[model samples]
Target: MVKQMEERHSIWLRIFHWTNMIAITLLVLTGFYIHAPESFRLFSNMDTPRMLHFAMAYVLVFGVIGRVYYAIVAKDAKNVLFNPIPDIKNLPSMMKYYLFLSDSHPDYGKYNPGQKMMYTGWLVMAICMIITGFILYNPNLFMGLGGSLGGLIAVRVIHYIINWLFVLSVLAHVYLDVSEGIPVLLSMFTGKIPKGFHDSAHTHDKSIGA
Candidate 1:
């Protein structure tokens, strides 16, 4: 039987998701240019790359802030934040479902435990990227701790290390989207999903009901 899906994503959610796609792509492009070897310079001057990188950072930060705020204010946002379902208790089973070993796992209402885990991981990583980013932004502060400290140089190393983590997360995020998020995105863009998809993704049918 064809299952009619409940509309889970609203207009604002779709907008934010796509907005992030643009901003993040630009940020990554400029960021790589800035961090890449000088011999492989993409720009005639460092000024353009630096400015664009910073500008994209600012936009990304605002998006992150908005996401957090929405988590507190929006019901769907709770799926990622509060995540009432999916704890250590259910992780094993959910993993099986993802691997296709099981026909199904527990039904999710907003987000599955697996989805919540990824969301929570990214939220925290984004925040850390912001904070550690500032630390590198001002290395003199680290020097105050001790003159022997490499100061900003040390901070640069730390920042550089974290940057890779964020990069890896993005790669993983892309892969997951290709797997499950693709279907979700299609649903968001079209405002519909396979009815069975809705039943499996969310816990309560009533919440998704039109």
Candidate 2:
């Protein structure tokens, strides 16, 4: 059989995706080290991890801004953003397919409802992390904000929780992508996938009915 390909991700998006991945990974590692040098022991000294952590935080800030700009300009928000009414309605079918209770799910365009929800949640979480991190990074600079949030301790706690959320969500994201197939996982790197890769299940359903 001849294999055809279709663009699944744009070049700019791939850039942002990989860039943010690196930044987030480094940030998480450095964060663990900074949080407890004795336990993590991933770094030799506080100076290096602290510097890398702050640097990656800035990288993440720009990566997010670039990704959002690209999404808006490319009109790709519809592919990833959650729509409450229709997406909520889509939940049952998607869940059924994932749980192996169904062989096929309705075609959900570029992404399933679950993916849309996850992406949207990640966006919100990233924004929250940025805000809390900024406040924690410089309490004096954001003293009013920190005080309003019950001081630096509270802000630090919020930042830490969000970091863990990022970790767990990224794991789930990778699992879901790979579960679909190796092609799905590679699409982010290659920016293309075998045409109709996502629609195969729905197409099978149609063929069976016909």
Candidate 3:
């Protein structure tokens, strides 16, 4: 049987997806070096990676803003935002599928409950990172606000913790995507997926109104 292709991601979404990925990868690398100048050796010296880190921080800021705008305009929020009630209801089946205890699961939306939760968490984490990052970047300017949050040391600690979370979450994300099948992974790059990929897994929840 000949399989048709379906558009899974828009050109703009794909572009932003990759741009954000690149920015995150660079930020993580440079972040590690900055966090531990003696241990991490991805860059020759602190100066270069520090510059790159600050530059990429701005890229991520705009990327987040643009992506949020696109999601709103494209009405894509339904596909990714975690709605506590329905998502909680669907979690058992999703967990079963992940645990190999179920062959099929309820179709939550474009993304499963797990994916929705993760994506939403990333949004929160990114915002946190940005806020803390800026304060750290200019301690004096943000000193008053930073002090309200528990001073510079507290902000630094939160930033470091979030950086680790980003690293670990990205690793899990890559593994889960590849495990689903290469086609699933490629869809983010090519913006298309084999026909019936979703159907083969389970019927999508049309009632969610994405």
Candidate 4:
């Protein structure tokens, strides 16, 4: 059977997604080496990794800005941004689907509640990392803010903890995406999905309602 292709992601969104992924992957690797020069042997010396880390930090910063701009102008924010009241109400159904207790979940716009939560989380985490990273990067520049945030030590701890969170979250994201089937994964690259793919979720919801 032929599967019609439908555009799920825009060209710019795909660009930003891949670029952000690359930037984050480099940041994590460099972060590990920087965190423990003795343990992570990915980098031979501090110079290269430190330089790369700083460069990728800037890359991610711009990526985030551009992605947010695109989301706003393209009217895509509604698809991913979590709306507290409605999202809270819809969370149970999404949880049931993931837990195998339910076969279908509500059609919560382009993204379901869980995806909205994760994507929203990554945004929050990214912002936190950026702020903490700068504080750590330039102690003197952010001296006042750093002191308010419990001094440089607190900022370092926040940066380190969030780095771990990013690693774990990315691992789960990769596994879940792969488990969903390659098409779902490929959609990130191709910006298209098999026709009727998204409809399947709502199909069951409607059937149950009827």
**TM-score for each of the candidates:** 0.76, 0.94, 0.94, 0.94
lDDT of 4 by residue, 1-210 (tens): 677798999899999999999999999999999999998999789999999999999999999999999999999999989989999999998888888887777778888877888899999999999999998899999899899999988899999999999999999889978866677789998999887777764543423221
* Cα lDDT tens digits for candidate 1, 86-134: 4667778778876777766676556767667777876776676565555
Full-model lDDT, candidate 1: 0.65
Ranking 1 against 2 by TM-score, winner: 2
Model 3 lDDT, residue 96, Cα: 87
Q: After superposition, which runs of candidate 1 have C-alpha atoms over 4 Å from their true positions?
A: 1-5, 39-44, 82-86, 138-150, 200-210
Tens digits of per-residue lDDT, candidate 2, 1-210, equal 667889989899999999999999999999999988999999899999999999999999999999899989999999999999999999999998888788878889888899999999988998998999999888889999889998888999999998899999999998877766777788899999887677774643433322
- Global local distance difference test of model 4: 0.88
Clashing pairs in 1: 3-195, 4-195, 108-202, 108-203, 109-202, 109-203
Q: Compare candidates 1 and 3 on lDDT and give the better one.
A: 3
Which tens-of-lDDT digit does each residue in 105-176 have in candidate 3? 876768999999999999999999899999999999988989998999999999999999999999999998
**What is the overall TM-score of model 1 with all chains considered together?**
0.76
